[model samples]
Target chain A: MRNCISCQIKAKVEQRNEDLNAKLAFLTMPQPASFSDVVLFADDDDEHPVPVPAHKAVLANRSPVLRAMLDNEMKESLSGTIKIGDVSYDALRAFINYLYTAEVCLDQQLACELLVMSEKFLVQHLKDFCQKFLVSNLNLDNSLSTYTFAHQHNFKPIIDAALTQITASMDKLASQDEYTVLKERDLGLLLEIYEAYFSKQADTTMYI
Target chain B: MRNCISCQIKAKVEQRNEDLNAKLAFLTMPQPASFSDVVLFADDDDEHPVPVPAHKAVLANRSPVLRAMLDNEMKESLSGTIKIGDVSYDALRAFINYLYTAEVCLDQQLACELLVMSEKFLVQHLKDFCQKFLVSNLNLDNSLSTYTFAHQHNFKPIIDAALTQITASMDKLASQDEYTVLKERDLGLLLEIYEAYFSKQADTTMYI
Candidate 1:
């Protein structure tokens, strides 16, 4: 009986892994198969843009923004083409691929790009993914810039996380190059960091 | 710091749930949207079969048999319609939806139908799902028939589990109407059960 129960657990885990791999493979099948209903181009200004073929049903199902765009008699829906401005082809491809399979290889730049795209597309899952990645990878060097980016999007969790990182290293924050940029462009954010840092300092002093 | 770490874990769980929900909703978008490239008919013989609209990419990606059929210059491919014979409309819809979302509401009969279809289509994940369902639901009443079904497909784990159930209740196994059916259709399977029962009985005797 014990052995049978253990086998069931093992089989369940195996099936889960197979399910994930199958969905991951589903992402790869779209490129070469040529059944895609729509083509997405990155950076509409580029004279010769690389087009990524995708299914409208998949894109719409994943994102309400995409659904609204495709569901209505919009220019994109009429033309069977969507032109996204200010994104690299690789980032666009990665974003669309992530729609098919919730899998992406994230570096700092790609994560930021996806973060912006997810926000734009109203894809909360990808937004959460990119936010978590950015939050975990935050350090003194990137905290100020990340905080600014998060502030622009009003991503509260990321803002709080970045503020925590920034306030923890207030002494070194001023010496960083991003500190100068943040102070010049967004003095309010720098002030918020200072307020947070001094409040934390006061709390520590009271505790002592 | 501890609070932040706990928050991150909570956020991760939330993100995973959102991801799952997004994919689940993806399965519901094919109907009435009209973006599907192909339609599947449950049975070919019906004069007026209800069409199940589905993306060819999704169907092809999930099952190698479907992929082979769609990728080649076959009748189904050319016609952009697939006729899955001997499966009920509900079962076929659930099967295709499972391919998209990896979610299904299974009953014993539906599980058996899907198990056969999954094996036919070489979809191991769904096969595992149905096999586990049947194995967990196995009892003395259904043991002989389930064992025979598993034997037909050479599903080893289900076969072993059914045999265990059958040999444990040897008295009940012989009295059931399915036992008579099994004896007539496949005497070898019946003999194998008898051989297993006696072997187990001998082991108990040796232990004593």
Candidate 2:
């Protein structure tokens, strides 16, 4: 009887979940069919950048960084051309599309690129999504690089997660070629990794 | 062990649901912050209609009717002025806001008005939302009105649900003031009510 009652509660929650899901579906907007009032350019596209046309309202709503730029009547807003430096055309496209639809097909590389972009734009949702993707995909091979990236982005959850993954595989980490490169590129990061490993070791000893 | 596995599965589903909810929040664009290409007017506010400025992109993405109107280079598209007849300023505002946000706090009257608006514009999500609200709020007092409203809008689910409620309270339905109004204004609706009641009776008898 108790399990049956619990099952009934679960069913009710599931129904509410379905309702929320339908609401989400209804809210996820399709990309504009036309009538765009702003254009974004990924500088990597060179002299004649491929312009991503979008509505200012959408850009402003999605990103506080973009909102400030648009609202302040900045050079980019006035000239009606936003040149985002360092991002590839594809990344910019996916980023803009995500702002419109809140959907992205992420690979490891795309996830990293978008996470960085999401941070720059102050789009926390996309940042969280990218962080989750990277965390899920983290391995001994990628953990150091991910840890560095997460550190660069000022992501606490990601740092803690990556450090946990890195510390767990510290022995194998020393054997990896990338580990040697990381030590050379950023000794600080290597120190932090060792520190996390030591801290975890101390915690284990305390447990014992 | 079985319960453990089920709990793990439920946890995963809930995590996915959270991801989807975050996506929905990100995708819900705030109504246009000044760069509006189209203005909507409630015809009831004829004297000095307070124009609600909105982006063509948002309007087009939300409703096919709006998309067609904007894309086909019609008069409304040409002037950027859409005159929606038969709606109060409040209903029109709420309707447009719902188009942007997929959210509305609905009471019965607003729900009915929005249902009509949603049907007219082919916004199925809003129509379903309003239909759900009306059905959930349905009772002996509002059953005939809801049934009539559903019939006019060709809402099958609401029609069936309202009919069920009405048929179960036939004696009470006849005594209601709105019943007298409906019987006089639309005798056909009364005939449909009797027909539904008889049909239900036959089905009940067959089950017995």
Candidate 3:
């Protein structure tokens, strides 16, 4: 009986996932007959901004910051045009597509760009996604820069994960080019890393 | 390492589920400022149909029937009003909500109603949901009627499940009020049930 229930639930979940994926076609293949009520522009495109056509309700539903902007009869709500500053056209397209589909292909650069956008917009799920991507892709080369970026946003998960990576191989990390840049730009963060390293050392010593 | 990957995938699924739920708020809470481009009317409400405000993209995206209606410069596309036939206002709302959120609270009656709507609209997920609901809820009381309903729709899963239940307790099913109704309405289905029962009996006899 329990197995039957389990199988039922599994089937239901699979069906729902398929349905959700089908929903993404609305964004990917927007029929001209379907009305798009709003357009978003990326800040980097100053001369001829290519409008990313979207639905206001979708943007408002996905992000509270966007909801507030659209809800308050702000310039964006009245104009039906939202100009997203500090975002490249590709990142803006990816972000808006994610709003509709909740799926995005992320490289490290794109992940970093999206993580900032997610933080700025208070899109926690996207933030978590980007954070996980950064964490999983963390290595000696990128740990310092990833940690710095995570610290700027106060993302604790990425901070902790990156810190663990950094402290685990402090010897190799200290000799890297990015580590010198981090030490010069943010000595406080550098000191904190050393402190964490010694604290981890103390714990390991006590156990030994 | 395998456990870590499993945990990451689980977390990603949970985050996507949450993001999908958040998207449903657009259907539930439509701000006048958000500019809903279409209104849907339920057929059951003739006097003054409550307009279910929605987006064309959402409707067209969720169902191919709706997409065809809106895509070919149909009256629904031109007028921005869709009249959903043979559905109650509540069911229409629930159906649209499910399109946006991939979530619904289904009772037996609502599940039946949604199943019919799903079939008409070719919404496979909702049909699967309703089929699972009926299958799990199958018993002597509902098996005959459920089998009839499933037979009408050509829903094989529900028909097979109902057959299993009916054949398992043929004596009790034969004495029920619904059995007389099923005999009157669809004698062929009753014969099929008996045939299935005898087949089971033959299998058991062969084993013995």
Considering every candidate listed, which one attains the maximal DockQ? 2
Prediction 1 TM-score vs. true = 0.83
Q: Cα lDDT of model 1 overall?
A: 0.82
Which numbered prediction scores highest in TM-score against the true structure?
2
**Whole-model lDDT, model 3:** 0.82
TM-score of each: 0.83, 0.91, 0.80
lDDT tens digits, residues B1-208, model 2? 4578779878887887787677777777655547778999999886988998888877887889998998878998899999998888889989988887888999999998898899889999899889889999998889888898888878899999999999998889789887889888999989989998999899999999
Per-residue lDDT over B1-208 for candidate 1, one digit per residue giving the tens place of the 0 to 100 score:
5578757765675565556555444433344235778988898336788888888878887798998998868888899999998899989988888777666789888998899899999887788889989999998778888998889978899999999999888778778998888778899999999999899999999999
Model 2's DockQ score: 0.67
Query: Residue B47 of candidate 2: its Cα lDDT?
Result: 90
Residue pairs with colliding backbones in model 1 are: none
lDDT of prediction 2: 0.85
Which segments of candidate 3 are over 4 A away from where they belong? A1-34, A168-175, A179-208, B1-35
Distance from true location, Cα of A55 in model 1, Å: 1.0
- lDDT digits (tens) for residues B28-47 of candidate 3: 33342256888899999779
Compared with the true structure, model 2 gives a TM-score of 0.91
Higher-ranked by DockQ: 1 or 3? 1
Sort all candidates by DockQ, best to worst.
2, 1, 3
